[model samples]
Target: MEGAPPAKKMKTERQFDFSKCARRKVALMFAYLGWDYDGLVVQADSDNTIEEYIFHALEKTKLIESREACGWTRCGRTDKGVSAFRQVASLIVRSNLKEGPGVFWPEGTNAANWKETTQEIDFCQALNGVLPKEVRVLAWSVVPEDFSARFNCTQRVYKYFFARGQLNVDAMIAGSRLLIGEHDFRNFCRIDKNKARLETSYVRTIVNVTLEPSKWSCDTASGSSAYDMLELTVVGSSFLWHQIRCIVAVLLAIGSGRESPEVISQLLDINTHPRRPQYGMASETPLCLFDCSYDGVNLEWTWQPRALNATIVHLQKIWVDLQTKANMVRRMLGDLEELPGASGDSNGMTDYLYCGPPAKNYIPLLQRPTCDGLEDKREKRNAKQNGAPQTLLTESL
Candidate 1:
């Protein structure tokens, strides 16, 4: 004992029995318009949402009994009324779905009715048929077990649209530059009591944030207040609740000269006390998650033209119907009010007349305490491991 060296402890590693494992790994690229649903995540007994459609397809395909059972995780949690052009979700299923070339379940319900038909159908085709028009399952891949749609993401790009009205575009883009780097964004996001479980580092880096004109001619569209569209794109590794909207509000303020570009720089500085600035959060209706990327992961995906094409056809019919109604309304109100200007405002000043004055500070749209206690403990452990400073807003002390 006096001269002997101590032995190094061996770490235990997890081993899976492939033969015994019934779980089939899967990843999906889905697109959805958040206007109708409550949110993406499924809440039992809650109304229909994107996750609900996914789980329904899973159970119908005999994939998993429940989302929890499937161990599903998503790339982002877009707010209600928001949308996603390319969102990803990963999960495991129990079936022939992962086997090469022949996975099928017949039409109609099963004997138990806990699931749908046992007919022969490709996994993607079956799910698309049952899903709603606003939501679509575009592609899928069977990824390694370690792959996480959320944790493994390299970059997430989001776009927000605002009607230009009287705001200045050049000023907005200038303010956005101040946010390009690592910073503690406590001021921009909602302080989630349960965030300790999801993220240890509140200091996420924003790779880029840019503002550009919408595809529609702002000059032509500005003649009608209802048609003007201004777009902002944000790219980052991760974002907290309400962060993007809050930042948009800040930029809008600066564009209108209600707040200076220096305000954004001040907010980025940790020493700036009263972290939350009083500012307006942009409207949620126009925000969309354009894409989410994972580096070095080779994923196979396919488009469902049959389902998507049908949806497009149906949308066109609806659009034509709406156009008729709009024309009638226009005829009824002919020359009643002054036509809007080319810059999206009646008077072309850099003032946001309808949006009101900018706040000296920022506040989240909603704030609530997390119900889960386990998440609180996780946050503390992560913070300590990551060497991040603790704060009142963070669950970890």
Candidate 2:
């Protein structure tokens, strides 16, 4: 055995030469179940991000040379545990067409006989083949090279789904109506000191907000109809980080009779409440980026029938698995409620939907401890950037 020659290693598949292919700018519409992901964006400390997986698929499929060289932009950045149905992103990538509008052919390529109606690469299929089942590339559209997914988006829609367990839906709806129109939302968002200055405007326009019954039905046999799902849809031009979650938290508080509908108006009055009250946001698991609208872009997304059907089938399977588990839990709850001393009340269920544990004693919103003002946060950030001592900065604050 020691004298035998070393066995030859099998040949690896040759990597595609992207330099020889034509390139074009494209917008991709994709969806993902984000519960298991770190977040939508790639981070330095973790590889479990939606964008990281997306770029990996692109590279594996030879669709893009590299993420750095690709002119990448996303319409929205969802937080950890959030999901998306119609999230969009744009980038320049290798194309199959040798000559066409927005296409860049390799040098010295003869394009005299190139047809204007030549077919392009099946981007959705290509990416989906390599991407995980939780993520799906729905469709792709060839766009102008100048198009930017983030900047060109005209509107964004978010949906938060929750159980209607003893919640006052009417009061919640009243509070949501107050959120319509432009308002300073500093009190309802987590300010990122690194990206925002003290003078940064938090004014954002909310076109509409609505509450409706979700399509997903509860198991009637398990007596779970009382916990029917409800959907809160928020439409806006843009939003600050954690704005939707914060708003939901407040609305849920109102629904639970802990705050009045007037609290919304009070928060919107920046002069009255400049600093945000220290309160937990709603859970991110129920939040979703529903849609991103680009009004005049004329993005005619192309979809392959086979790929579309495959995506549908995969999603159906996931729904069946989740729904079955939910039903089992509901049945257990129903059985527990049948106990002799059990009370059927579920008034406290909403408390569990909040990100942090509920306080033992409820404090009114205005009376609660408030976060530092934007100016103070900016000053502290600047001091830290200048390498000031932590103790000195704390004393200064």
lDDT of 2 by residue, 260-328 (tens): 999999999989898888888899999999999998888988888878999999999999999899878
lDDT of 1 by residue, 212-263 (tens): 7788535442145443566788999889888887788777667766667777
Off by over 4 Å in 2: 2-6, 106-117, 195-199, 222-225, 381-397
Model 2 TM-score is: 0.92
How far in Å is the alpha carbon of 50 misplaced in model 2? Answer: 0.5
Q: Give lDDT: candidate 2, residue 278.
A: 84
Stretches of model 1 off by over 4 angstroms after superposition: 1-23, 94-121, 195-199, 216-227, 314-334, 339-397
Give me the displacement of residue 76 in model 2, in angstroms. 0.6
Compared with the true structure, the alpha-carbon lDDT of candidate 1 equals 0.66
lDDT score of model 2?
0.88
